[model samples]
Target: MGASGSARPAPFLRIAQLLRDRVTSGMWSVGDQLPSRAALSAEFGVGDNVVRRAQEALIEEGLLEGRAGSGTFVRAPRERRVLRRTVSGTTSPAPAGFTGTWEARSIAKVPAGPETAFRLGIGDDGMCVLTTYEFFTDSRPVLLATSWEPMAVTGGSAVVLPEGGPLAGAGVITRMRHLGIAITRVVEVPRPIRLNRDQAHLLGLATGAQATFIERTHYADGRAVETADWVVPSELWDITYTIAAPPPGT
Candidate 1:
């Protein structure tokens, strides 16, 4: 809330979003000249000053640029690459044609955060094995993952530490299977969010950049054996989901 205390943004902010939508929707393209502010003002039924403020906002977001005499043009187009997602389970490497590598740190006996505890069906004070991952393709970071597995499920077992022991680098599916736990289903929910300072730093992006947040949980015996938060930069990657089909009719 600002001085006005109205929850709604100003006219300029709304106008700016409309302009950005055109570029992102491919109705406008890189290097394409935008309609003059006066023209847009007439179309939007707003004052030219409001239009200018809107354009300035888009420029700050790197979506457009203003020329001294040539007027405004679309500077950057929202181009995103595809990242394949399979239902089989992820905690692994990137797909073929791309080399994916990640650095992970596992901390044991850590208290679970509220969200983590809820996802794992445990109390807030429950102990969990938290593993944070920084996944990259080549030298460019693409994805971030933070997994929390209830120690009640893996503690005192060979798979206590997700990144250690004989099962080092082995994903949740394999590790849980070795412990005789059959993961029958996986559920993922996606959310749109802005990058925090730390996440933006690792992804080489500016703070408040757009990203996709995925809450993925693996279920075994109707219990959430492992739950993870995966972050993907919207500026770079588009998530593609691949669903496997059954072989024959029952």
Candidate 2:
């Protein structure tokens, strides 16, 4: 607590995060002038030195750019990612030389993350079965898939079930057919994301490599049944969605 009876940030880290959030949220736009040092100290209830340290940290993090005569300004936003997602009744089999292809890798039961829960419409007690398989085309390594299946529909049997069940297949349609479930609709959410070390190792690429991220959802009786995140190396894979045209006379 300072003289004004206000609590200050723990040290430089809290201040750094505060500034980062502001910049990320567009509260401080690019080329925008920063508050004066004295004003910042007053607002944060910290000393001038502490404010300076926070400013320096932001500059180092590339969140702010300092001008010789003028004050610091927020950095520009990073480039956006272009993603493509598609859903179809039929899916091609994995290319030659792959052990299990895309869908045969299903194995252990794992907890679903927040996004998975929301997509699958399940609560904390909901369990998800996750599996991953690396794929190749023409003797060159390519896509990596991390698929999730909700336990409610599978009656927890899917979690302990081995990979070589009747569910193994490229398209969810085939799996649904084997499970005796009729798929009513399919949804695909496309996103752009960089490959992490684990994913890179699986895909035979370097960490931080550019990749197209795609999440395709399969629905049964209007309920989101399963979701799969497909990661493809920049040069190895491509996805195209075919949107139907308008009616003949309209």
Candidate 3:
């Protein structure tokens, strides 16, 4: 506070802010290696611990990533897009050259668990068609989802199997619409969870790594039609939803 009688920010915080400004200004491009801790410390007139703390803060903010035996480097931002669900269909658009494909397997006539039955508004003893999906983008597995539909709703229909028939790969809303059940609304609850052993193996993530979990339900004419759980690696995807606001006076 001697120079101008104003207190300076903490050393690490000041450094962190400078680094954030550099990243935001594109001074360091994605995948660009940052200066070493020793070099930064010397340049900034701080100790190595201060530089380390600053770098750690950037890493937590997803601006930098550390590699074993290498160094910290800038991380590429994930692609962000809106998942639009409309009467025509449900579509999630990806960037050019990024094809989002999924592999799915359906198990028919499975007994619904208590939670599943409650979500679907069916008896605990009711049977369901359970389908598991693994989604890939650019040939890399990135997402996993499981959907349960009460057999009473789609047991005898041609779209009984979610990934079968002419409506194959079409989302639940579209398929149910074809069955004369118009899906009017969907509810989603998103939470954070650590990846389990199976999820880690499939998504190529470290066990216990943070991931995004979403529980979604589809409602048709006040009746629940399908419920699903979607798991996505936090580093790979950014999920966004856009809803139109109603006009004034209805």
Candidate 4:
């Protein structure tokens, strides 16, 4: 309840739900043009901004699309591919049946930013090796990644450069193992994000398009060894997780 002592939904959300019901109830079919904001505002006795905000929310959900010089229309649902992954298992670059190719550039002696410093448990003045990656399938970009490792951990070592020398293209566990670091576990946090120009351009998506951003960190006995950020367009993929079962007879 608000200060007025009555519970009420936000104006935009209320309007959005009404519009969604219309579509689902057969009042508006796929490819049908949506009512103008002016019409909706007059019908709801609300301002035009309220109606527009509601429409924009549906557009982000892939339910409504705006055509240039034309009105808004209902959009068909996207056909998505499933990306299944296990929490505690060997990491693969992509899901099965998708043999994608990637281009990566590793730069050494880079300074760690605030977020990287926090993740790697290092000071603000810590130096790092930063690697950027772009993965493609069917000649179209689908994934973007950037990884950071503290230089203090791999400096002057054969495994310093992530994609160079022997054991090149090998994952973090193998490389860290060569350095006598036992990578115990990996942690990942997935969140929603709006793609910037650089990311959207490579993926052929519009600026500010929605995507899944995953921040991953590899740990060795509670010490963070590597951190990376990965992105996948929301319209083209859905992530599925498989949880490991506990031991029997605990």
- Candidate 4 backbone clash number: 0
In model 4, which runs have C-alpha deviations exceeding 4 angstroms?
1-79, 87-98
Q: Candidate 3 at 153: error in angstroms?
A: 0.3
- The better candidate by TM-score, 1 or 2, is 1
> Model 2 Cα displacement at 32 (Å)?
52
Clashing pairs in 3: none
**Which RMSD does model 4 reach against the true structure?**
7.0
Pairs that clash in candidate 4:
none
lDDT of every predicted structure (CA atoms): 0.81, 0.64, 0.78, 0.81
lDDT of 3 by residue, 1-250 (tens): 4476678888999999988888889898998999999998988899999887787667656687655557778877645433432323363211123367878999999999999999999999899999998877656567798999999999989989988887877778778878999888888888999888688667655556678898889899789999999887776666665667799999
Q: Model 2, 84-107: lDDT tens per residue? A: 343443543332223333434654
lDDT of 1 by residue, 1-250 (tens): 5476558889999999999899889999898999888899999999999998788667547687665557788875444578776645444423323356878899999999788888989999999998998887655576898999999999999889887888888788888988999889988899999888688667655567789998889899789999988898887787888888788984
Candidate 1 pairs with clashing backbones: none
Query: lDDT of candidate 3?
Result: 0.78
TM per model?
0.66, 0.55, 0.65, 0.67
Off by over 4 Å in 3: 1-88, 91-98
Clashes of 2: 0
Sorted by lDDT, highest first, which candidate order results? 4, 1, 3, 2
Q: How many residue pairs clash in all the candidates, one count each?
A: 0, 0, 0, 0
Which of the predicted structures, 2 or 3, would earn the higher TM-score when compared with the native?
3
Per-residue alpha-carbon lDDT of candidate 4 for residues 1-250, written as tens digits (9 for 90 to 100)? 5386667889999999999999989999998998788999999999999997788778767787665547778876755777665534353333334467888899999999788999999997799999988887766567898999999998989999888878777767778888999988878899999988678656655568899998989899889999999898888788887777799987
